[model samples]
Target: MKAKNGSMVAYDGEMAFKKLSGGGEGIRGMVTRRITGEQMTVMEVKGHGTCWFADRASEINLVGLQGDKLYVESSNFLAADAGLRTGTSFTGARGASQGNGLFTTTVEGHGQVAIMSDGPAVVLRVSAQYPLTVDPGAYVAHQGNLRQSFQSGVTFRTLLGEGGGEAFQIRFEGDGLVYVQPSERNTIAGDV
Candidate 1:
């Protein structure tokens, strides 16, 4: 119904909810876990919605959920709902085997979902003039206002200091929002 200061609210029926809780004053969403079955904790992020886990996900089942408009960094997002398709860009991490990267897909209808690893997220405003550049691992979801493409100019090989282009990046242009996490994913020994 209402949020604290420094927070923006966007509601789309019960399918979408957004809480910009950070900066200046401080606004945290109300969260409550409501599941007592067998397995992990199923936290209902009040207006934040819910996240579904896939069998391949490591640590937690699913990550964060988005109602209205939300941003998620790479490490924070274990996996997102299959609703959005994978973008053509990817990047490899130090200890990563298959190259941990970012993906993008348009949310059908009038809503979308985002999963996160840690707590509340930070929302950044992106426009044509001031685009956003994020680490390959901290992105979660974005509004359908931007375009995803490989970085131009410097070749991947030159950027990675390798022989060829092994690392990849997503170039976001136009206008939209990006979600990022403060933490990177902790690699498990046998995660691959």
Candidate 2:
């Protein structure tokens, strides 16, 4: 499995950790990530049995993917099966609103991934009839065939400091599940 560097807490069996420079994406991926500013450091863990991984005691959620892609922020990603492919992709305005820059991490293929959040994560289903809108700071990860668009409620009132607390959000349509943390992060749009 590939896990975030320095996230391993313990293991009951024999294990080896090898630092995967450039997020295990090789030279080309390294260059791409560096240029996009979505850099992530990963380590390959092998011969593991009951391996434990954690980040600052954050809550962890396990997601299973069956040949589908998972979109997650680099900060929330914990680990994934080695068979899965991991990379970076552009996130447009949603990323900017969260203060996470313009790119986010992606995991694909048939495998399980572990994601971390500040608090327990709520899995919200988004169907054709029931779309879901999420605060950028509260978003953790999403899976399935989902289309995400940035939504803003800012108006003239916002300029006068009377805006709703949630002025920026990411709306998900199509069909998928979105993971949202109970707590929101400190973001550029936190007060908007």
lDDT of 2 by residue, 7-86 (tens): 99989889999999999998988998999999899999999578999999999999999999999999999999999999
lDDT of each: 0.36, 0.94
Q: Residues 1-192, candidate 1, lDDT per residue (tens digit)? A: 211221222333343324422211122111110111101111222344432333223223222334433333233333333333222122223113213322222232222343443434456667879877654444545654676555433455554655333233455777877655564443321121
Candidate 1 Cα misplacement greater than 4 A, ranges: 1-106, 111-114, 152-168, 186-192
TM-score of 2: 0.98
Q: If scored against the real structure, what TM-score would every candidate get?
A: 0.38, 0.98
Q: What's the TM for model 1?
A: 0.38
**Can you give the lDDT of residue 157 in candidate 1?**
54
